[model samples]
Target: MTQNERIFLPWWKRVVIVIATVIVFALQIMLFVFAFQVNFDFPFNVWIYWIIEGGSFVLVYHIIHRPILTNYKLTWSILILIFPLPFSLLYYLNQRSLALPKYKQKKIDTILGNYYNPNQIDCTLELDRKDPKAAKLARILRSSTGYPLWKNTKYTFLFDGLLKHEDMLVELKKATRYIFIECFIISDGKLLSELLPILKEKGDAGVEIKIIYDDLGSKATLKKKTILEIAQIKNCTFTNYNPLGLNINPAFNYRDHRKMVIIDGKTAYCGGDNLADEYIHQKKRFGFWRDNCGKYEGEAVQSFIALFIEMWYISTKMVLKLENYLCDYVLERETSYILPFGDGPSNGAEPGYDIFRSLISSADQTLYISTPYLIIDEAMIESIVLAAKSGVDVRILMPGIPDKKVAWYLGRFHYKDILLAGGKIYEYTPGFNHAKNIIVDGRYAFIGTINMDYRSLFLHYECGALILLDNEIYKMKDDFLKACDDSKPITYEDWKKRPWWQKLISYLLYLFAPLF
Candidate 1:
């Protein structure tokens, strides 16, 4: 069956699309007639300009504005019709030429002013002296700008999605006050079904339950109405981030890719694993889908809760009670220091790329990295090369069988330079590996939605924790070693021996890497 047949569309959406198309067509016709009547000497070049300019405007308008339009439809429609063409043309050209103006930079700086903190270095040194593990973790966290520091926090790092799912279920069952879930892709599969009933029961018992899922991430997997219906039936609130529709903005590419769950403001989970059977290797199609996640308790959980609240408000227009959830719950038992960090497109000052770069720069012993995509920016590429050149052991594992062929090829484009610089590259031969993580110096580790790519760094919403404790770091290191065992190492000689056609394509993809 076709995708539309597989997932039903709302009747209202169909009516709105029809009306929008008519309006757009009418506006174009009116503009053409007015321009002709107003100026009898209108040149052929001017007419061609109108056709090209006006047509481009209509296409973008249809694609962006077609999605969710409730109270802001009229206002948004006016803005799209009046502004998008000229604005988009300018934006597209400037971005293409890498010539963004100073004002844009200032605007970005203003947005990200809160992302950086110079005091983190002192905190890292202090934590290291008091608890070596905390210090190491602090160093990693400090590497990334905008990552907040927490005084008292507990962290549990899971090796794979199996452990993550089991632990998440346990936490969900014990949730007493509230549960907030935000994920880029949430499939209605075994993992979700297991907790659905529990979430429903908790919601019925007066617990506040809220969820946000990205529309594009869940597209063709779950119907919007099905999600809304389930939310209503369970008395839980649900919102979709960046729903795709005609007349939608181009900024739809900036998606909420974070996968996090905060329970009662006491415990939280964040990592690369999504709420799907495939993530846990429960499905037969993808064999051994290895992934990782980190669980946080105490003060660190508060940061995650705050991140969830921010996203919830952005998606649902609901201001959550942050003060109530910010209570410090100190643990008597000794636990490693942890810091929860969040990143996104709006992260003007604390761009996730800078965080990843900082982590790469501070490597002492070894840096073991795992990610699905590797379309890295120039700075990240230089950092990895410099680290390897400086005698810091750097090993990276990418997918052998990628879900996106273009991304896989683009990932290989860096293999030659990485290997030449003394870095080791491995490709997991056993199906797709979707985990995004980095463990530095076998002391500091990070697991989150952010990939070592431009999309995750500057576009998508991402989150992860800077884990300092030795136990978690060791576990992540072991996981990386285990993954290496299942991977085939790509050497400099191997990359140099690539077929002529493959090399040509890889070179082309590399040129367009920034755009991707």
Candidate 2:
């Protein structure tokens, strides 16, 4: 729904926030200068100073109390110990900006809660009869994560953005009730230029259309005038998520890194490909930009709609009823199960990371993964190593052509360790592989927008679909096998001689990974 009034900070609150932020940062600089640059001799025993010494104690207490990643905790501890007041000021600001108010998060959850309520499937007996091990994995998914395994949901695995581009248009032309598009990035490029006309025509046909894009994600490509014009379209609504401003807020780190398209609540698409030229290879950036997109047709699309409604509420504060957009279309039971789920910085559960860990730990025969970036933490490393060491055929495919050099090196940082543990690593020799997919024992297929990096796991909103016992699982496995032919294998011997300087750089970058 479109509205004239926005749920936003009043002008006075905005002024206060800006002024306070400026004063805090200025004081931080002054403290840094005073502590290191200008040493004064007016002190009688520095340890006797109550405020500084007490603040040091307070920093220690904060470090102990803050529920942050261990690596980040250690890194922050080093900074706070070295520069107490400045780092403490930064810490306060970071927390202030990063944490969404509890009431707002609760409101968002309350609106979308029922859709995510746990409901077990009765077909587990059947699943168990066929494959007991996969059934066990299914139980873990439903018990640990709230998403229930659903039947009669159909899935379309679009291997690349080019393929997704062709199929998405076919589905868009059939939208009867409404259209919702949310993306991490929506740049002015070949993709949008081609899709906007279709959206405009649908809007003209009295279809309710809404577009939500990440502010930072599309900042470089989408212009304000473009958003205004889109809003002017008939029955069209638009909002930029976590819109940019001049204020120094901690929220800058938390992003909407999800990409999905929900049409009439009957079909939904989710994957790593953003609406940019490079993603579809319209305007190539790093050779061939290979990515994946998956479309769900049936009841599972409801989860994606709920996710969109949550973000729409968070951004516009508009009241939305889930049932109005939900389609009651049912499909024949072809796939064993399809559970669409989301994860974010919010409390309670992190479905994306939890499921990934569960799959890695639960695999019996083989494990395969493809991702754009591989900036994992300790827990993930342990899982991969343990799985490989246990004789599970573990293999990971990475991009040979780099998009961000630092992220590539960070992935390489784990090469020696993972290779030594019997894990096989391959780099796609053709170009960048932005596809994020994981297959285990050819029984489960996970395809979505999540990348194997710190940002996607810990700092951003992400979503994916887990396909179980589907014929597409075999297709996913076959795709991996085909990719292997075009990929270059990296063995322990190959990693052993890579420049020591590069390893050192990756380690240093990895230390501050949580910040990125």
Candidate 3:
């Protein structure tokens, strides 16, 4: 087996890790001394620095000496020989607090208790085929098993960013109740210029408007003053999600990476497109940045509204009343099946990863996935491998030129394993493919802001729709096939013959995949 296939750590590497732990502990002691010299006048600040530096020493010591420390005799010997009396007492207290078991609370069964009447809802689209592939694909568009979400909704697939911007502006102009907009990136571009004026106009006309955008995602593209000025002038509210700074929590890994617009809780717009010109090919970089988005009206619009409201509350710390925002103006349309689902780190019971896993396992005929970042975890990799082994045709499309070189190499590292398991991997030769989509068995399609990576699965906040047996599925499938025609396939033999230095770099990257 190759290094990537092995799960165990080598003995030499373990020894090196132990040596590094000792060095880290020594560095922490030096930091503590330096902090004391500079912070003697400020007792509180000195204590804080000591707590941080001393905690690092204790952590490193425990990690390095864990095996030996487990034995009572060796533990006593090391403690007596290593630490001064006061330091030993402090370490003992810290360890005891960490080990103590706190009170456990019983899980409350807060049953919203099936408030939905499935008989009253006609959202499921029946498929002609009874095969697993078809059923799995069909479920992508089906209403999730929770709360009868996305029922009685209308959907419009927007092909151009400019056109989408125009449609959104027109929708905002018609809003009579409320408006909620959430995005990962909102740049000062032609698209924003066209929509911002309309947003301000609606806000001034007594329409309730709320906006949430990621601070890091738009750091270089937007100015704080611009957004603040707009909020002040238009009587609108704006909040930045997870700002970037030295004191920011590492949990900033969980980002709001969705772009959505809901007008009056009746019409909603979502998909892979962000509020930028490049997404519409207006300001091209590597190539004409081809992308897709969807607009929905009907019951599914309610789900979109709920998602927006949930995010708004998290960002703004304000509770908005649904009755006040969603009353008589909701448009009732009859043609499409739309299921808008939000995925985030806080989804404890029904995680989006499980939903994705279910869809992949149910595929019996074919599965096609396109993603720019492909750093999938072991479970996802296993699903793809098993599907290929079961005689199901599985294909993935990745960019030939990557936005992140390390992630690109890590993805290439998996090509040999996938091909050996009977899957096909294609590279988009023209330029980067920023589209995140999956078309299963030609009957179900999923398009949204979630990438197939660790960040999207376990960290970042994301949202998307499952298009089951809808007209949009046909269009997405056709687009995928056309993309395949313009792509080059990678063979197992080709991958195995990659340069030794390239393989070594990819191997190192695989070790750090979890952090990425």
Top candidate (TM-score): 2
What lDDT does model 3 reach?
A: 0.66
lDDT (0 to 1) per candidate: 0.71, 0.78, 0.66
Ranking by lDDT: 2, 1, 3
Clashing pairs in 3: 141-468, 152-299, 154-297
Put down candidate 1 lDDT per residue, 1-516, tens digits, no spaces. Answer: 122321233466457655765787588778777777776586785677586657666655653443321212332343445455664453343221132234543544443344433445665666767767446545444544345666556677787888898888888888778888899888877877787888888888888788899999999777666686567745588889867887535456678899998888888889898888888777845556878888887766767876777677556655666677655566543445567777764443344554577678778779888998898754467789999999999999988777888778778888877888999998888977788888888766678888877667656778887766546678778889988998999988888888887788887666446555
Regions of candidate 3 where Cα sits further than 4 Å from its true position: 1-147, 159-163, 246-250, 327-336, 497-499
Give the range of the ten consecutive residues with the poorest summed lDDT in model 3: 103-112
RMSD of each: 12.4, 9.2, 9.0
C-alpha displacement of 301 in model 1, angstroms?
A: 0.4
Candidate 1, superposed: residue stretches over 4 Å from native:
1-42, 46-125, 128-147, 333-335
Q: lDDT score, residue 343, model 2? A: 73
Clashes of 2: 0
Ten consecutive residues with minimal summed lDDT in candidate 1? 67-76
RMSD of 3: 9.0
